[model samples]
Every structure is written in C-alpha cells, then in structure tokens.
Target: MTAMSLGPAYSRLWTATALSNLGDGIRSAALPLLAASMSTDPVIVAGVAVAGQLPWLLLGLIAGALVDRFDQRRLVVLVDCGRTALLAALTVAVLTGSATVAWIYAIAFACGVGETLRDTATATLLPPLVNDADLERANGRLVNAEVAGNELIGPPVGGYLFGVAMVLPIAINGGTLALAAALIFSLPSVFAPAPTSESKGRIWSETMAGLRWLVRSRRMFTLSLLSGTFAFVDSMWFVVLVLFVQQILELPAAIYGLLVGIGAVGGLIGGFLAARIVRLLGPAPTLTTCLLAAAAGQLMLGLASEVVLAALGLAATSAAFGVWIVVARTQRQRSTPRDLLGRVTSASTTVVMTASPLGALVGGLIGREYGLRAAILLGVPALVIAACLAYAVLRERREPAP
Candidate 1:
C-alpha cells in the first residue's frame, strides 16, 4: 500500500509521534548531562536513569489496561499534555537555579509514567487507521520518524542547546510536547471496541488477560521472547561500546560521537527500506536476515581495532535493529485481537525493560573483568540463536493471519 492511502488521520498520528519522540530524545540527552552537572556522585547520577525506567516496570501493565479500557486518542492527548506540564515545571526549576538531583529524578519518573500511557495508547490506535496488509508500511514510516527524531536530530540539538543555556533544551522539550498534545487531540475518532462483559473486569485481571492470550499464542510468545533477548544483548553491548571505542579502537571522543551519528543514519535508512525488504524477501526471511546481520555486526565490533571498521559494525547492528523493530511490531499488530493490542504491546515492553538493566549491569561487570571486546563478543551467540529461532518458527506456512 502507498503512504497516501493510509489516510490523513494516520498523518496526524505520525506527526504527533514524531514530535513527541523528538521531545523524548531531547530530554533523554539533556537530563543525564544535567544530572552529572548537579552532583559528582555516581549513584546520584545513575538514579536519574533508574527513575526514568522505573515506570515501565511498575506501570506498564496498568497503562495497558487503561488503554484497553479508555478512548485511546484522548488518553494519548492527556498523557502528552501532562508531560508538557511536568517539563514546564522542570524548565522553571532549572532556570531559577532551584533544581536538585532529587527534583530531576521525580520529574523523570513522572514523565516516564506519561510515556507509558501515551505509547501504549498510540499503538492500539493505529489499527483503525490502516489495513492489516499495510501495517508493515505504516509501521515502517513511524519507525523512520522515531529514528530520525530520537536518534539523529534530537540528541545533538539537545546537547548543543544545553551548552548554550541549560534551560533551553528543557524549555524546547516542553514546547514540543505541548504541540504534540495539540496534534494528537486533533486526530479523528477511531473505532471503539464494543463493550463486552469481559471489558468491565478489574484492571489486574484485564492486564492478566493480555498475558494469557500472549502465552496461548505460540508464535507471538516465541517472537516476544526473541525480542526480549535482542533487547538484552543490544543493551549489554552498548554499555561497553564507549570503552571499546576509546581503548581498543583508540579513537577520539569526537570519533565516537561520529560513529553514533553514523549508526543513527543507518537506522533511518533501515526503517525506510524495511517494508520494501519485507515484500522482496518475505517476513520470516527478512527477520532472519536482520538477526544474522546483527550477529555479524557484533562480531565485527568485537574484532575490529580501527575506527572505520568499528563504525561499520555499529551502523550494521543499528540498521538491523531498526528493521527488526518495524517487522516485529507489524506482525504483532496483525496477529493479535484489537482489544488485546495495548496489553500485549505493554507485556512485550515489560520483558524488554526487565532485561535491559540486568544486561547493562552484566556487561559493565564482564567488560571490567574480561575486556570490552569480550563483553561485545558475548552478545553474538544470543543474536545467532535468536536468528535460528526466527527462521524455524516464523516460516511462511504457519504465519497466516487469523
């Protein structure tokens, strides 16, 4: 399906998502820099990261249940508006010189709560705007926007703005979110699920209902587990990537930043091309190729001593990740019941959230003891295994839509 065929409602959704993610990326970069400036204590600095992630673990299911129960368009608009308010307060604190490490942590956690709700609601809202056959295309466009805004443009802009004036990035983030809220509020009405007796069940049970459905669907469960593994390995490898660039590759810090930008560019390309690749190779083979490419990329990073080689490795891995995201999300949306989309998406996110920190800790330890290269090398086997599983389980025969 063509992009225009997806309709104007989807365009508004896309614009809102891109704007919100740009704000997210700006805050992500600025917050840590702000934290480190406030306190030299490592624990205090780390607390900001932990606080931002805590909501995903604590509220993912609850947010999903709420999305399933409510009007999704209004839910996302409210969440974004709430986030804008929080950021506006934060911007004021920074400008007034009243901001503390504790203040930053609180706002981070609260904004994270808003993120959980907005993201889950947006995911569930998409199906009504596009046909199932066009999900891959639609999802690819969204992923492209996310990669461009979050990785490519937002961080550099945030870092630059922070250097000029600490309050600038924060204020800009607030403005972007406020605009995003307005855009989301303007989306046309979507198909609301007919209320069933089951829809009125308690939140906990409704959340569990999503898990039960995921567990019963063998294909989805397997795919989600693989996705979790990918998230784990990716997070773990990234923790040591800085050290690898500095120590093994002997590249300057500027080179390291350049490599990250290169990787982000690769992700943009990958997301843009994903739908076409899927059409050419079929979904199973495309996913399998991406996994294998990720494995190869990690191997290259582990072995390379030169900046050129290392950059290539990082870009390859990032591109593979980008493609995998579009393919996986499209499959999930197509296979699941509409009523369960929010919950299933959140359940998958919970797995990723739970795995990432553990992976980061493990990577830090292993890299410190064994070597940075070894830490990256260890991720290769996991990706290879995931690739093998994707090929075996996601074959064309068994993947027909329900």
Candidate 2:
C-alpha cells in the first residue's frame, strides 16, 4: 500500500511480473475475441481456454522438478523468451491472413507451458530473496502489480488495441514479454537449486516426490483440495460469463474489456490490503472470508438482471481471489521446506488449477444445455460449503487429518 521499497531486486522482479502480466491481460482478452470471430461455437472458444490451462495437468510436476534441478533465474528468463517468440509467431500468423482456431489453440498451449515453468521457478525464488517476515507483504506487492497490470490496464488496452487492428495487441504483447525478460535478467540468481538426496532417476519419479510430500502434509493437502473445488466452479463461471456478458447482459467487445478492467480494480484493492487483512484476521479467517465473498459474487452474477449488478458481482469475485492468492501463497511459502518450495508450489498449483479445463468444457455444456444462468447458479452452494470446510480445516487445532 505504501511506497516503501522492497529493495532493488524485488523491484525488478515485481516490475517484470507487472509488465508481463499486462501482456497477459492483452493476450487473454484478444485471444478469446479472436476465437469468437473465427467461430461462434462456445465449445471451440472454450477449447482455447482449455488448451491454455492444460499444461498444469500435463507438465506441472515435470516442470517443477526441472526448475528445482536447474538454475531458477535462467529458467524464468528462457520461458519468457519462449513466450515472446510464440507471440511473435502468432502475430505473423494473424498478419499473413493464415490464423485459425487451431493455431490459437496451439499457440496458447505452448505459451502455457512456458508460463508453468516460469511460475514454479519464480515461487521458489521469492523465499531466498526476502525474509520470512516480509513474505506476505512482498507477495501482496507482487500481486498488486499483477492485478493492476494484467486486469485493470491490460484488458482494456488490449480490447481497444484490437479495435485499431488485430495485429496491434499481438505486436505489443511480444514487446512486453521481451521487456519482462530483460527485467528478470537484471536480477541475480539467488542460488542453484540443490538436488534432492534421492534425485538420481527419471524426471517423472522426481516429479511424484513432490506430490508425495504434498499429500503427506495434511494442512497443505487439505487447503489445496478446498481451493480446487472453487477453481473448478470459477472456471465454469468464467466461460458462462463471457456469453452472459454478450448475449444476456448485452455488453459489446470494448465494454467487455471494461468489465474485466473493473474487476481488476477490485483485485487491486484486495491485493493492496491482503497483508494487513491476513495479519489482523490470521490465515484461516482470511481464507474463509475469501470463499464467502466469492460465493456472494457468483450469486450476484447469476441473479443480475442488469449490467451494473453483474459488473459489481464480477469485481467482488476478482477481489476475493486477489486476497486469496496473497494469503494462500504466503502460508505455503512459510510452511514448506525451502528445498522443496518449487515442487510443492507447482504441485499445489497443478492440483488447484487442474480443474479449469474441465470447468471450461462443463461450463460450455451447461450453458448450451441449461443456459448460462443455470451454469453459474449451480455452483453457489458448492462454493459456500467449501468455504465452511476450509474454515473448519484451518481452525482445527487438533492433530492434522490423515
């Protein structure tokens, strides 16, 4: 919330995430809109999203282990460079008049692979860069940059840029990613990841080592499980909301960018306050509140008969998630062993996000079969119940559950 510097290195890392996520916002908005033009079918549009998230399922563990076994700084830089190249290629495809839905899907998946690798390494890098006491605050600042850059400014900019020309946003995305890599390159490598004692085998076996560690930790495992349920529901909400915005709420393309931008404003607020809230309420209550807020937001979105109601609901939902990310990631960072941080973070991310593809598919089906409102309305109770369960789990002072 304050301008208190997080030191020069963290400043660079924070800037990199913020700058890259701005491009992320542009790409996410533009890609879906581009897909919509290529095909009106919700399923095809949904598939692009599925492709984007599929790497978490397919490569999360392998990537995590590789991150742990290699130089984290280089891993992040290489991934950024790869993402930059992929965006450049996508821009060319669009300009040459040869872009297709299939090309979008392929490019999205490739970029996602790069993202998964970068995120694991980045998560591992933080603990070394900052003291334990500052983890939550640092996480908040990082997230604030992400929410503002990606959501608040990026989406709106992307939507307007697309109106100027399809190539406009794509060109900018590539440039931004290149900038991010350069910023990251400015940060020194904290240290090389020390190989695990039993790290003398194939990567899959090495990968499962992290999952096994996660499953063995009752607190981490339970929290991840609870979060996954909401993530699944949230993905469904996301898909249906696009249709809800255009078909039901009747917002046009540019305004859809504004709608996402509004939500990001809420996210920025939440991210700014995450550290203070977590300190005041403690981790359990902070997480419990996030779940309840998310449920309320979803209900508002489902029941809204007007644009303002839906927009407010979306803003609330995004704010809740922004708060949730700060609290949950800090807790994990504090609790996990430093040696296993990359693997554990990756494993948890994989578990929580693994539901998104399914959510995309199911949300599309529910929208097509039952209608968009039904798709959204169906998940409200599940979310609330998950909140209750998360609270109960976090509050348990007794021995950890097996």
Candidate 3:
C-alpha cells in the first residue's frame, strides 16, 4: 500500500513520530557525549544511560494500564509536552553550569517516564487509524520515519550542535518535542481507544491481564524473549560503542555521530523493505533471516579492525534490527485484542526494556575492565541464540482447523 492510502491520520502520526524521534536522536547522542566529557569512567557514563531506561522497568506496567483507560492521543500529546518541558529545564541547567551528573540522571529518568507512557499510548492508538491489512506497511512507514529522524538526521545535527555549544542540542531537542506535541494534539478525537470491560478493573489486575495474555500465547511469549535478548545485546553494544569508536577505532567524537548516521542508512533501507520482504518470504522465514543476518553483522563488528569495516557491520546490524522490529510489532498488533493493546505493548516493552539497563551496566564494566571490543563481542553469542530460537519457533506453518 502507498503512503497516501494509509490516510491522513497515519500521515500525521508518522510525521509526529519522526519529529519526536529526531529530538530523541539528538538527545541520545548528546547525552553520551556530555557524560563522556565530564568523566572518562565507563561505568559513570553508562550510569547516565542506565538512568534513562530504568523507568521502563519501574513504571512500565503502570503506564500501560493507564494508557488503556485514557484517551491515547491526549496521553501522547501530554507526554510529549512534558518531555519538552523537561528538556527545556535541562537546557537551563546546562547553561547555568549547574548541571551535574546527578542532575542529568534525574532529568533522563523523568524523560524516560514520558517515553514509556508515550510509547504505550501510541501503540494502542494506531490500530484505529489504519486498516488491519495494512498494518505491516503502516508500521514499516512509521519505522522509516523513526530511523530517519532519530538516526540519520538527528545524530549528525546533534553532534555538530554539541561542538558549537553543549546547550544547543538540548535546547533544540526541546523545540522538536514541542512541535511533535502540537502535531499529535491536532489529530481528531476519533483516534481514541474504544473503552472495554478491562478499563473498569483495578490497575494491578489490568496489568496482570496483559501479562497473562502474553504468557498464554506461545508465539508472543517466545517473540518477547527473543526481543528481550536482542535489546540486552543492543544496549550493551551501544553503551560502549562511543568508547570503541574513539579509542579502539581511533575516530573523533564528531565522526562517531557520522558513523551512527551511516548505520541509520541501513535502518532506513530495512524499514522500507520490511513489508515487502515479509510478503515475499512470509513472516517466519523473514524473521529467521533477519536474526541470522544480525548475528553475522555483530560478528563482523566485533572483529573489525578499521573504520570502513566497522561501518559496514553497523549498517548490516541496523538493517536487520529495522526489519525485525517492523515484522515483530506488526505481528503483535495483528494477534492482540484491541482493548488490550496498550497493556500488552507495555508488558512487552517492560520485558524488553528491563534488559537494557542490565546490559548497559555489564557492558560498561566489561568495557572498562576487558576492552571495548570485548563488550561488543558479547552480543554475538546472544544473537546466535536468538537466531536459533527464531528458526525453531517460527519456521513451521500451522494450518488452521477447518
């Protein structure tokens, strides 16, 4: 399906996603740079990163339950506005030279709360806006926008802005988030999630319901595990990646952003091709391929001795990640009941995101003690296990009972 065929609502959502993600990319790159400059301690730097994701582990389930009860569109708008305000405050802190590692950590944690809420609400909000049949294509387009803004354009711009002034990227990030909030607020109220019986349940019960649903479904549960594994490895690799590029690869900080942007090129290509690949090869085989490809990419990255080879490895890994996300998310959306989408998405996200901080901590310690390359190499084994799981679980076609 063409982009236009997805309707104006999806387009608006897509645009807003891109805008916010652009800001996300900027902040993501800048935060690490800021932390690294302040202290060369890998664990300290990783702590800054870890704080941002900790909310996912702490508040993820509660946020999901809340999303199911509220107006999802409004929730997203409010969350974006909150994030904008948070960044604006951070900008001020940075400008006044009052920003300490602890201050940055607090702000990152608050923003991550917004991220958790906004993500759950958006996943629940999308189904009403697009046709079920176009779910994969629509998801792919959204992924495309996310990669373009967060990875391709955001990183390089953030890196440049950081060199100009530390506060510039943070300030600009707030502005982009503000714009994203406005866009989301503009959408019609028809975008609201339909109320269901679960809405009346207690928060704890409602949260449990989502977990129960996921556990009952072998496919979703398996996929969630695989996703969590991938998240762990990805987080580990990225936490130490800045150090790798600077110390091991002998590249400047500016070039690090460029390398991430190059990796995004692969993400963009994968996002555009995901739906088509799923159509051509079917979801199972396609997912299997993505897993194996990611494993290969990680292996290449771990073993690379030069910038050119490292870039290729990053690109290949990103491509696999992009496609895997679209396919897996599309499948989840398709399999899930509409009323439970928010909670289910939250449960899944919580599971996946919980791995991130743990991975970050491990990566930091390992990178500090062993080597940056050793930290990256850790992902190779995880990906290989994930690939094996994918093949075993997803390869067979189960015919429906007549």
Which ten-residue region of model 2 has the weakest summed lDDT?
Answer: 393-402
- Write candidate 1's Cα lDDT for 99-153 as tens digits: 9888899989998999888888888878888777778889988888787777888
TM per candidate: 0.94, 0.84, 0.83
Once all C-alphas are superposed, what RMSD does model 3 give against the true structure?
4.0
TM-score of 2: 0.84
| Model 1 stretches with alpha carbons more than 4 Å out | 1-5, 199-201, 399-402
Worst 10 residues of 3 by lDDT: 393-402
The TM-score, computed over Cα atoms with residue i paired to residue i, of candidate 1 is 0.94
Q: Write candidate 3's Cα lDDT for 1-402 as tens digits.
A: 556678988888888888888888888778877887778889988887678778888899888888877888888998998888888888888888888887778878888889889878877767778888788899998888877876677888898999999999999999988988988898889655575655475899888888888787777778888888887888888888888888888889987887787877888888889988999998988888887888788788888879888888898888998999899888888777777778888888887877877888899999999898888887887788788888888665552211
The per-residue C-alpha lDDT of model 2 at residue 392 equals: 79
lDDT of 3 at 72: 85
With candidate 3 superimposed using the best TM-score fit, by how many Å does residue 121's alpha carbon deviate from the native?
1.3
**lDDT by residue (tens digit), candidate 2, 1-402:** 442476778778888888888888888778887898899999999888778778888988788788877788888888899999888998999999899998999988998898889878877777777777778889988888777776677888988999899989988989988998998888886758665577565788877877888888877887888777877888888887778888888878776777777887888878888888888988889899999998999999999988899888888888888898888888888777766778888888887777776787898999999999989988889889988888878765454422
Task: Give the winner by lDDT.
Answer: 1
lDDT: worst 10-residue window of model 1: 393-402
Error of 1 at 192 (Å): 2.8
